[model samples]
Target: MDKIERIEIAVIGAGLGGAAAAALLDDAGFVAHTFEQAPGFDRLGAGIHIGPNVMKVFRQIGLEDELARIGSHPSHWFSRDGTTGEYLSEIPLGDYALKEYGAPYITIHRGDMHATQIARLDKSRLHFGFRLSDIVEQDDGVLLTFENGRKVLAGLVIGADGINSVIREKLLGAERPRFSGWIGHRALVDMNKLRSTGLDYERCVKWWWEQSRHIMAYATKSDGSEYYYVTGVPVDSWEHSESFVDSSREEMDAIFGGSHPMVQGLIDATESVTKWPFWNRDPMGLWSRGRLVMLGDACHPMRPHMAQGAGMAIEDAAVLTRCLTMTGVQDYATAFQLYENTRRARATKVQTISNANTWLKDPEDPAWVYAYDPMNVELN
Candidate 1:
């Protein structure tokens, strides 16, 4: 048996949600440690929209200004017809988001934002290359066994480990996430090639087609140096064993060719592209069991259509931290209950709409989502 180390809180999976949870918990004066499986991270080719809702949380953690400085502040989230370039809707952002939603909305490189999050964490408490392999719940605490021959007894555990969370499996049993019949092709376009078309691409836009197939494109930087896009296409099934597979410009043309000039320009700019299958799980009946609890994708995995998946996870981190602060680690059950009460309905609503892929497809008020202040919201 490995020597049993002890900790107050153990947060598994240092992804967006896990990192946020660890940060918020530490800020609230809790001794929390974050464990990640990967030895390190890479600057992957992907983009994410950070809604004002989540920016508020980032503000609480003191990262709002740095992120705002690094990310692109689009004037609006434009939805347009893929073939005709006809405007379907233009939802206000930029200054409008700052004034109305209590924070700024920005589209940024997912890797850049993630690196920023990881950088802000306490170095001593953040552990890399620690893959969680087994969990044992006890009366006073929980035992965590990592594959690296490390053992830890944590008073409380937060499973921000994502959809395939080992902690989640311990609670709900071993089951694979169901494929949502959707795959997204992600790519970062060659900026020079894109500019050669001489057509101005909006800072943030979603090109829509029939059957809900579309590409969400936006700049990842404030200076517009990096542009990225992710496409959602329905498929019969995902047979590939790898998480993602390579795709080519010809494949893109075959699927979205002869559309609008701008759409054609994007294909021409595509140098390297990869396609990934989206996996999902239904709304869980259990968000926590004893000292083990879950947040983000572990509790409510959804499609990324709404662009609020990470936002929800970060929000969960904030709220969970608040709950723990209220009840203290000794009363973890009450804290867990409050966390679920505060998060469930909202998370479920977002999950439902995200799976439908209808958010922001038409002009409508997004205040309910973008305006929510998780840091100050009343805990149930």
Candidate 2:
């Protein structure tokens, strides 16, 4: 495919979502550029699930093989009792997803997925150390100002920045994301360490549901390591900041140190933990205004209970590329509207369902979520 020389798209915040959107745009022969706030490695922490809905998008973008190499398909999803470590229910994902959804339910480190998309994105199109400060709409396009006193212009802007999005604030109004009143504790255990305690590292994605909190553990990558996440009540009620805070093993011990041995042992083995409060934003009444639009967390951030964050952003990129198949600014408006119409309800449903069932979802959710394909779908 010949590259389109004239700039058409400007992606704000070169995280996984932004980078994936840029790559898909480039694949569509559009001149798409990206500006990122931080240097490399800004999103180096945490882990995420790459479900079939995500893989379906990746399959369309020609990167499923790489994702497969970096991630492993979970055999099943097991819901267990946090206090007793007894199974509550289970659903097969490894073979079932492949057979039903034409993709795998893989789990990988969030950083790995981000890095994969970044590698696929054209480096010449990426501008680093460019934090977005403001967006000024113009007759032909939008003028974006960066904190570094630089300006760039493109026919349209896509905000793939995370929950705290400056583009969203400028495009819409400033809005606060709601906290779920649970502090998240996350850590990665090397396969060696997991084996040291005979932990099941690759059997399934395990969820230990308690009253108001839960523990989720799964294999992060093929490198013989496990990624574990535990949700617990905050030590203090004074509204805790949602930023990830470095915490000690001792501090975590005060929370889950004495649960069932598997849960407690997992906490005890964690060398360090970064605790953060889970926060999510409700879907906006509108996702686009004129030439500016939003995607991923900027548009629809949901709880990790459903593990669709990365997949949703990638789906946004793929669908945006498909919708923005023309050159004119008028085409951008149509594309933006079509993108939002196609995505808003689906993303909102995931947000609502995940929030409703924090640790479990309806049996129909897997089919509704995993069997989705962005490429061949009709827009709402």
Candidate 3:
């Protein structure tokens, strides 16, 4: 038998959530090692919204100011009619967010944000190319086997591995995620072409059509040079084997052609686009079992309609770290329970609202979502 390495804590998956978990755990003075199946990550063509709720978590990890500097701070979240170009709602978020929500709200390229996160982690403990192949519950800890033939004994395992998490499968058995009968077309439009239309694009806007079909567009940079959009459209089914399929401007025109001039401009500027099927799973009855626990998409996967999917995941990391700090690692069961108790209600609420696709469609107070402070929230 190969000599198995022993770690105080193991975090699977080095994506946004897992990276946050590892960083928070480290900040809490815990010796947590992060393992990623992939050799490394890239600056993929994607963007994300960081609300004040999870920005507090980033603040704890010393990332808030840096991220705020790199991202676009939209004055409001504007929901507009797709065809008429009339504003349905405008929720204040710039200075108002700073005053009311206790932090800044920004939209940034996902890759840029993720790269910033990965850079702050302790590199020696962050292992790459270690795909989790098997796990065995033991008397002292969980024995983890990687596809690379490396073995480890982790005192506690956090499955931040995402919707197709292997640790989730270990807890609930193998089950594929359910398709939500929706697909999102994501693209970064050509800025020059968009500018040629001579129409001022809002920093952040969601153009809505019938049946809740819409395109959420925004700037992904501080200078407003890079713009991105993701559209939600109902579909019968997803038969593709790959994660996403190539899309084109022609397809954009076919679906959203002859709408508002601004909408028309976005379609005309589309250079490259891809369509992805949204996958979901009902909130699980189990968040932790034995020495194994889960966070982020591993436990509560939801649609991106509310743009809180990553926010919720990062919030989980903060709460979970605090719970462990309160109880200590030896009392992990109690800590895990506290983490779940504190997080379940809020996470489930976001999941339900996001799936309904009705958040910020009309004027309403978003205080509950944006004002949350995961770092300071009382642990249950």
Better of 2 and 3 by lDDT: 3
Q: What is the Cα-based lDDT of residue 306 in candidate 2?
A: 75
Candidate 3 C-alpha RMSD relative to the actual structure: 1.1
Give lDDT tens digits, candidate 3, residues 102-209: 999999999999999999999999999999989999999999999999999999999999999999999999999999999999988656668987655567645565
- 115: Cα error in model 3, Å: 0.2
Order the candidate numbers by lDDT, best to worst: 3, 1, 2
User: Which whole-number lDDT from 0 to 100 does residue 235 have in model 1?
Assistant: 90
Candidate 1 local lDDT, 1-380, one digit each (tens) = 57899999999999999999989999999999999999988998899999999999999999999999999899888888888888887789989999999999999999999999999999999999999999998977899999999999999999999989998999999999999999999998756778987755566656565445888788888888778888998899999999999999998888888887787888888899999999988899999999999999998999998899999999999999999999988998899999999999999999999988888778878999999999999999
Q: Clash pairs of candidate 2? A: none
Residue 327 in model 1: shift from native, Å?
0.7
Model 2 misplaced regions, further than 4 Å: 1-6, 230-242, 326-330, 359-365
Clashes of each: 0, 0, 0
lDDT-superior candidate, 1 or 2: 1
Model 2 scores a TM of: 0.92
**Tens-digit lDDT track for model 2 on 60-158?**
778889988888678998888878877777778988889998888888888888878788878899988989897888887887777888777678889
